[model samples]
Target: MPVRSPSLVELNAFLAVARAGSFRQAAQELHVTQAAVSRAVLRLEQELGQAVLARSAGGVSLTPAGTQLRQLVEKPVAALQAAAVRMRKTPERLRLRLSVVTSLGALWLMPRLEAFHLLHPEVEIEFRQYHHDEDFTRDDIDLWIAIKRSAPQRWPRHIAAQYLIGREVVAVCTHERARTAQTAPLLLAQPLLYHSNFPDNWALWAQAQGAKLPLQRKGAGFDLVMNLIEAARSGMGVAIVQQCLAEADLASGRLVIPVPGSASTGRGYFLCRRRAQDAHPAAELFAQWLMQQAGAPPTV
Candidate 1:
C-alpha cells in the first residue's frame, strides 16, 4: 500500500464547501465555479478514501470525518486570513472601525464625528452602519454602539461595555400634527408607528403614564427608526421614538414632543469593545472624545 499526500488547494475548497454547506456559495467565496468546487471536494475525498459528506435533499452535510476536518480547518483558515490582513498594514495612520445602528449613525455619531476628526487629523474614522442582531466582536469590529441590557455577566469576558446614555422615549409628531392635536383626538388616539425592536414601546410609555396603552389598535410598522421618523415627519403618524434620535428634528421645530413623560425600558445605548487595551489607537481616541462630549454640558 502507498500513502497519498493531501492537496492544500483541494483541502481548502472542501473546507469552504463544508462551512458554507453549498457548492455554489463556496465557489463564490473561492472565485471558482460550482463544478470546480465539487471536483475539488471529490478529489480530496478520493485521496483520503473516505466519505466526508452526506448528500441530502436539503443540501450537503459533513460526515464525522468531514466534521473533524472542518473543525481543524476553520481556525487555521481564519488565522491565515488574519495574518494576511495584519501583514499588509503599515500603521502609518490610526484607523478605527465603528459599528453603529443606522439611526444612531445618522442622528448622533455623524453630527459630532467631524469635531473629533478636526481635533485628531491623523486619526481616520471608518463607519459601518449595522443592524441590531450582528455581533460586533465576531466581525473584528473595533467598537459597537448599541442599545443593550446592562448585564456584564451575559457578555463575553473579552468585551467591555458601558452605559453611555439614559434611555428616553418621547412622543414625537410633526409640528403641524402637534399643533392640531392640542384640541382634536388625544395623543393616545393618534396613529402609532412602531419600530421592530420596540414594538411594545408605546405600551411601555403608556404604562409609565399610568394608562393602558392602545398599541394593538392597528398602525404602521417600520423596520428602521429613520423610516419611522420620516413617517412621523410626513404627518403619517405619531411615534414614540427615542429622544436622542429626535433631537435634531425637535430643535429645528420640524417635530414636537407634545407629551411629557420618559419611560425607563431598562435599556440604553452602550459602547462595547473587545478589551480596551488592544483597541486601535484611533478607536481609543474616538472613545475618549465621545466620553468628553457625553460629559460636557448640553450646549443646545
Candidate 2:
C-alpha cells in the first residue's frame, strides 16, 4: 500500500520550532522568517490531521501528538548525525583511546608511550588523563592504566587485568637529614610527613617495624605524592614514598632511603580493559612490548 507523507522540509521546520519552543528561534535555525516557520507548522498540522503545537505566554509547546512524533524523530536524527560524522572520518588511521591516573601518566606512562607509538606508527593513540575515577562502560577508553592501593571490585565484560608494576615505600630525606638520622629514636622523631591519600601510611610502617612512637602527632600532609617527595628532597621531612617514584631522587644523592625495611601495602599499578581475551591490535602490540620492557612474568 502507498503511504502519503508531509514534506520533509515542513517536518524539519516543525521539529526546529518544537525543539526551540519559539517561532523566532526556529526561524533563525531554518534561515527563514517567523511567519514562514508558522506556515510550515500549519501545513504539517493540516497533513497530519493534528495540532502539533500550542501557543502560550511561554512562547510555544508540543501538543500530545507532537510529543509522540518528536520522540520518534529524535533518535533517527541523532543516528543520522553520528553516521555522517563516522563517514567523514578517514578510515586509514586507527585511533586508540586510553585513560590513566595523572601521576602514572606523567611519571611512568608518558615516557614509555613513545616506544609503543614507534612500534605502531599507523595507530593514532589518544590519551585521556583521568584524575579521580573512570566509568569503563561510558567513557570511550580502550586502555585503562590505574594506580591504586587495592584492586577494583568489578571489571567490565571482555576486560582483562594484569599487574603492570610494583612499588614499595621507603623513608626519603635530604642528604643532611640522612646524615643526621643514623639511629632509631631519631628516625621516629624527625617530623615525618604523609601523603593525604595514605594518611596512616607512616603509622602503619612504624607499627610494622615494632617502633611505637607518636606517629600521628608528627607532621604535615600533602595531597600529591610527588609533592610529598619534593618536600622530603628539600629536607622538609622524611616521607614514605614508592620506590619507583623516588628512584631518580635517591640515585642523584639528593634523597636517601633511611629505613631498609618495607611495609607490604599490597598496592601496585594495574592495566585493565573491557575485553579480557581479546585486545585491540595496537593494544596487543603495546602489551607485548610493555611486558618485554618491564620484564613481566610469562603468565602476565
Q: Which candidate is the best by TM-score?
A: 1
User: Per-residue alpha-carbon lDDT of model 1 for 1-300, expressed as tens digits?
Assistant: 765766767877887677557787677657677899899899888988898888788998999999998777755654554344345557356678788777777887778877877776667677776766755555657788866643232556556566676476878898777765553237777787878776878887878877666534656889888899999999997887878778788878888887677787767787777643342556655665776676654333
Best of the candidates, lDDT: 1
- Give per-model TM-scores: 0.63, 0.60
Q: Residue 29, candidate 2: how far off, in angstroms?
A: 48
Instruction: Quickly count the clashes in candidate 1.
Output: 0
What is the C-alpha lDDT profile of model 2 across 1-300, one tens digit per residue?
A: 765777767777888787557887677656678899899889989989989899888689999999998878755654453344335557345677778777656655666677766655666878876746665554577777766555345544444556676545667788788777655457878888887887767766777777766735677799887788888977887887766666566767788777677665666676776542232555544554664555532120
**Lowest summed-lDDT stretch of 10 residues in model 2?**
291-300
For candidate 1, what is the lDDT?
0.72
